[model samples]
Target: MTESQFFTPHDLPARWRRKRAFTFVDTTFSAFLALWQRWHDDENRCDRLHVVALAHLPALDTPPPADDPSPLAAELARAWPMRVPGTQRLEFDAGRVVLTLAIGDDIETLLSRLWLRADAFHLDLTATADPRKLCKTLARFAGDDATVCAFTADKQQLERALQASGFACTPRDAYTDAPVTARFAPRWRVRRHEPPLPCEANAREAIVIGAGLAGCAVSSRLAGRGWRVTLIDRHALPARDASGNPAGVFHPIVWRDDSVAARLTRAGFLYALRRWHALESAHHDLQRTGAGLLQIADTSDDAKALAHAIARFAYPPAYVQPMTRDEASRMAGVDVERGGWFFPLGGAISPAAVCAAQLADASANITPRMNTDVTRIAHDGRVWRAFDASGAEIASAPVLVLASAHDAARLAGLHGEPTRSVRGQLSVLDPCALDALRLPVIGEGYAVPLGQDGVLIGATYDIDDADGEIRADGHRENIERVAGMLPALANTSPGIRAGRVAFRCVTSDRMPMIGQFADENAARLNARELSGAWPLDLPRMPGLYGAFAFGSRGLVWATLAAELIASQIEGEPWPVERELAESVDPARFLLRLLRHGEFCAA
Candidate 1:
């Protein structure tokens, strides 16, 4: 049935006057109905609604203390729809609407900060509710005719909060599990899913060149946007090269002093995690079960520095924590010698499974071009050509992305620039004794419990090693490094190492080179100083983009990088920091030099 059918008016006394902002105070079902009615009744505009998530959201059982040590309150305050922390102000839809979050045990601060006559007030007390506090705070903060939706499965608490805040909440169909008993609640079920986007525009077709994590993720997003995508990979399936690692670990690269790398990794990590959750539910098997990452301090001094960093930085609970060695061991299922900081959002995944799931989501259009190698790339003013085995053109698209790692740098047209390729070898151990150890993708070299096969150990970084052969020395080095971290893994009696070697592609600056392509001659000539060029127009290399030089931060950085590249091609707002985008621009460094009369092409 349509949403309009759900609206129900409140039953208030004649003397009690209700404002438009505070009008809908019926039962829980009515509160939802009012929200639905309001959303549907309003004109379809791109106006962002200011939201204030009032009330503490707790973990499973215990209620959050009145003054909790965690930063959840601060995070919620900063991330609230309207608020951007440290700015004391809220900008909605670029300042069309403003918001101020009221956070305090005192009722005055809560009332004063909650200024907006809210279109909807999300009163989530699913954690634990103090009715007296809820009533005192919301009663003063309630705007005229504003609709407030309060939640609590506890009948008494629900009634108490509703009566105090002048809200009348009736139960709606709860299709979700009850908060206390996560098992299915019989009366109502809440099927949590992404709300359907308003159907306004028709979908367009997209072609993504690589089927690695980046390509796979972007393809999934495009599909989510109702766009048909053709994901082409040289490999028959996905993750054939560096992406072929059996257990692809996921973690945000947190740095010291909230550096550029740390900030970028944080945003990218959050985006990736959200996208993973939004993907079709059937793909859960691909995601390995584990807590977030536990990043051990590189050194003791660094550990002290990290404690300070965690305090200063705005870290979400999902990804930041400083724990003692004892605490770290408890968090991770094993013994950690050094005290470590953990990213609660970090975990490992089966790379193959993620790729397969993305392809499956776009099964109708993501055509896999297996064993079909593209010898060279030639941009013919309009479209780029992809050649086959016998020098015959296979497929030509207006947009061509070179995501083939080191292979893309070797293509003749790009004038062999130095794209470093190194051989990385990893060993997978049997899960016999290692199963008991709690390995959570540790720092330096890690020992991860691979499903059934064993724990994955050792990843030797061999730079300038062109041959992607599994070197015994490299394997031994990895083993030694891992042994140093875990200590217990030194004994080879129970843990046998099975090596898998892959080549990593890197660039001079270590950033993944993305964006439009330039002629080899032009790039070489203008390679000294390049910056400040919008929609760069030199040689007409249309529909040519490069997504390579990822180094070893592939899993951590690829997905967001892919989206940024795609957005550049589509002329959409870049999905990353402007400086980062500039840093990765294919011709940014080269173009600046030519503009400054420093042409040095050999």
Candidate 2:
């Protein structure tokens, strides 16, 4: 029995009103968004729609006059936030609908990296993106029988290109802003680039090596996705490494031009807040000083500059703002010498409690193997096995993720790529000495007040320092840095012989590695075929991944990175953009070398 499915590109209400889940691509978003607002069914059940809108997104560039009459104009004024040149995902109707806005110059280049397949398409073609080239690009992601509706002034030019590009076209009357309907089914065959296929695993079981914040986070995200995660660690419990800090602060960095570090951290900070709230709703116990952490500037001039950025970027007052000396001193409950920025949403949190909470929430799906040192790893064609010092198998699974800080590259056999360890130590100050302090204040060093646990300070960032033993000089340096910000701290000296020392895993570029581990051997062999390769183009070690080199940003980065990894494993839409994803890709170094022809001579 052969039955043909009828498809048309009408207004959202008339075209896709009943669609439970649909993937759509559009150039300008106004028409589709209008359709979605009227046609979406939220009262019955959770609806699902994936929309990729390619546009300059004029509203983000500059707002319309406040007195504009149109709803779109009003929205452009009221809802506009940060919009740099990249992919932006906005959730609506409780995440039942997601709009992935691609705001850049090249539509083909941006669309090429998306891992989604389109079920329908809408376009507004201009002479710059001629109808012919645009149609060809749209065909790359369209389903076998995808339907398209396009808007353009030159109706003849648009319809001709759609017909040539394998669409059975018929001019429809005012069905949409566009007057043409094109159904995809080509007369001639053409080779088109397909997005990366999701990785297939032999089993649902996986072994995560490490019990630090990163490992615990990875385990929880995977477990929530129905994976049986076996968590192995060399230590007895989670957060006993660098994550063992008595208390840590989490906030986004601010740069004058909103550099990559600033933009990426801003996203990370927001996502982490939502993730933490979810974990809390699941009954995870988290200990913190509410919110509002103050960061003193390194110098008086830098404080003024940062204050200018906060206003220039129009950051929400709930996130961060500038503070005068008296204002900051009032927040800290102590007399601070210099003015700085105050993070209203930032505060000190117990790292151990977070790690424990994640593990407990996922207890049913997570199996913890404590003190099981994983010294050697091997893959037996299908499953990966971890061995101890005695060469006895301790854990086995179809997938493996290395989140063991500096040990990750070593375990994954990626040592020559230049990841190293830096030793840091945090000192616990006496409560009486910090009695006047109210909130966590950070400058060269941070001072976190834990109330009954006394105050936490220090954290000297000594590079290439491997000795884990706490030193007297380290304590002195911590006290000195803190004292520089709060003049009253000059009288106190508590870190002489008391502090905890831990090694931090750092990368050459400072961004954490979060993705599938690329197979260097395969890349070297396929060099000619991959002369111009992107991160997704690199050959990957099947079912193996890493979330390492987080350095001091573990508090802010761990949750988001874990979510990114989980999205990859579960074949879900990514939480971050393509360019940002590439920035943190594990094989970026290898791709850079290939791009530079560094391996061609050998």
Candidate 3:
């Protein structure tokens, strides 16, 4: 049977889409022995063979009553090697030969799921006489190593199969039943067994699924708290999504009396500034431009409302000052018919630079697993397993956190997650057009800046659209918006334009979703009625957590969001208020559903 037959298209996972090979073949003890001998001869072989003794063979333990290998295989199948370090050794052939234990339960499944053309095949122990599993395993392992044979008494048959498969093979006979071993280490190894399992009273190793700004920040903070963490990302590099933007603005949008969004944004903004300052040495070309965001008042009503809101907050003019249309034009270096509010301390930061710095400075407690994508999440009674598409458990930890934008929803554990992907476009103008504009990070409909090389102008917000493709029409529309905002500079450069597009993950309420996935939903459901009877509100999957729904407010949430998540993992008081901390809870959708009859009704 083909690998496609093993899994339905819809049931297939993303990790499988990225697997290395997909072929299958049948094997017997004779084939296994012959292939093992070949790998032993080829010292430069890159493909390492792993053999997990399905069950201890008769000699090692007491022999079973039945000679049927199927029953024995079933018993051996019951015991799975959860996660083996990348450097384990198994002694076989009575210590005369040594084999590294590299293969496991899902080896065949995962191998077939890969998308690679060839895998350096070595003799593996996962095959059976059954042609179906054999074919599946062989197909998956049909890489550079596909030509290799396993230790088998039927050397003649093995030679024929190799030739048919276009492999040049030489087989050898074994003198004794020396328990041929194939215990090798994993490619991405971490010390196992030393730390207690989730079974350990206090789990030390935690797993984080996404390596975005939020996930990386959380991992760093948790590592600082002395917890060992594995930060995994589907992308080969960190901060490749919204965090990949060249530059991003940061500021707290304060409303009267400090609304939930305002208060949290304020806290998140300040925390981020402080965090960046602490990490400055590691980050390059970082500067506080001093230019604040100016919210343009479109009408008399908007102007009055801005003034009243500023006064209600009682903030110093430095943080929330009002400027007339004339002052706004001069400060912005552009003409504006309306007045606006300016935030002096507000500014922008190069996002990728910060993320790179954080990853570089990450502690020993944090191990970054790049290019590993997680497609399925399974809770096997004790520990939560993050598996790739091939159904191979890649990483297992007491705690699992999902920080990838909307990708968190892909996990069955987070299938009901409340996050939305939004499309946004930003533009850049030529040097001449930029020279006519100021270098401050301005806001309100459209903002302009003189970046390091040229003037940066933007942006178009489309909440319902999630396409990352750069749209010429969107860029043209944004240019028009900018022209209207500063009519005096309309003809500065008629055809000047260059732009980029990206997607933002948002929630219905506009606030970030940060906190234990379990409790947030419980609280949301009980907030109206079952308040007292809510479960411990802990995460459904003990170590599984998430940080998402950041929307366009990534800068505002990355810092405090990380702090809040790290605090929860450490069992400490949340950096922000309880209400604000739970405001962006991952399980808010679940709570909303319980409170409102329908989930999306909110």
- Whole-model Cα lDDT of every candidate shown, in order: 0.55, 0.75, 0.56
**How does candidate 2 fare on TM-score?**
0.82
By TM-score rank, best first, the candidates go 2, 1, 3
Candidate 3 deviant stretches above 4 angstroms: 1-201, 281-288, 415-417, 448-452, 464-466, 489-497, 519-540, 597-602
Q: List the residue pairs that clash in candidate 2.
A: none
As a whole number from 0 to 100, the lDDT of residue 495 in candidate 3 is: 48
Which has the higher lDDT value, candidate number 1 or candidate number 3?
3
Model 1 scores worst on lDDT over the 10 consecutive residues at: 180-189
What is the C-alpha lDDT profile of model 2 across 251-293, one tens digit per residue? Answer: 8787778777776687777667666765677677777667589
Model 1 ranges off by over 4 Å = 1-207, 222-230, 280-284, 431-433, 491-497, 519-540, 592-602
Q: Write the per-residue lDDT of candidate 1 for residues 201-298, one digit (tens) a residue.
A: 12355556667776676666555444566666788778787788988677776566655566556556665664455443555556564656677776
Ranking by lDDT: 2, 3, 1
lDDT of 2: 0.75
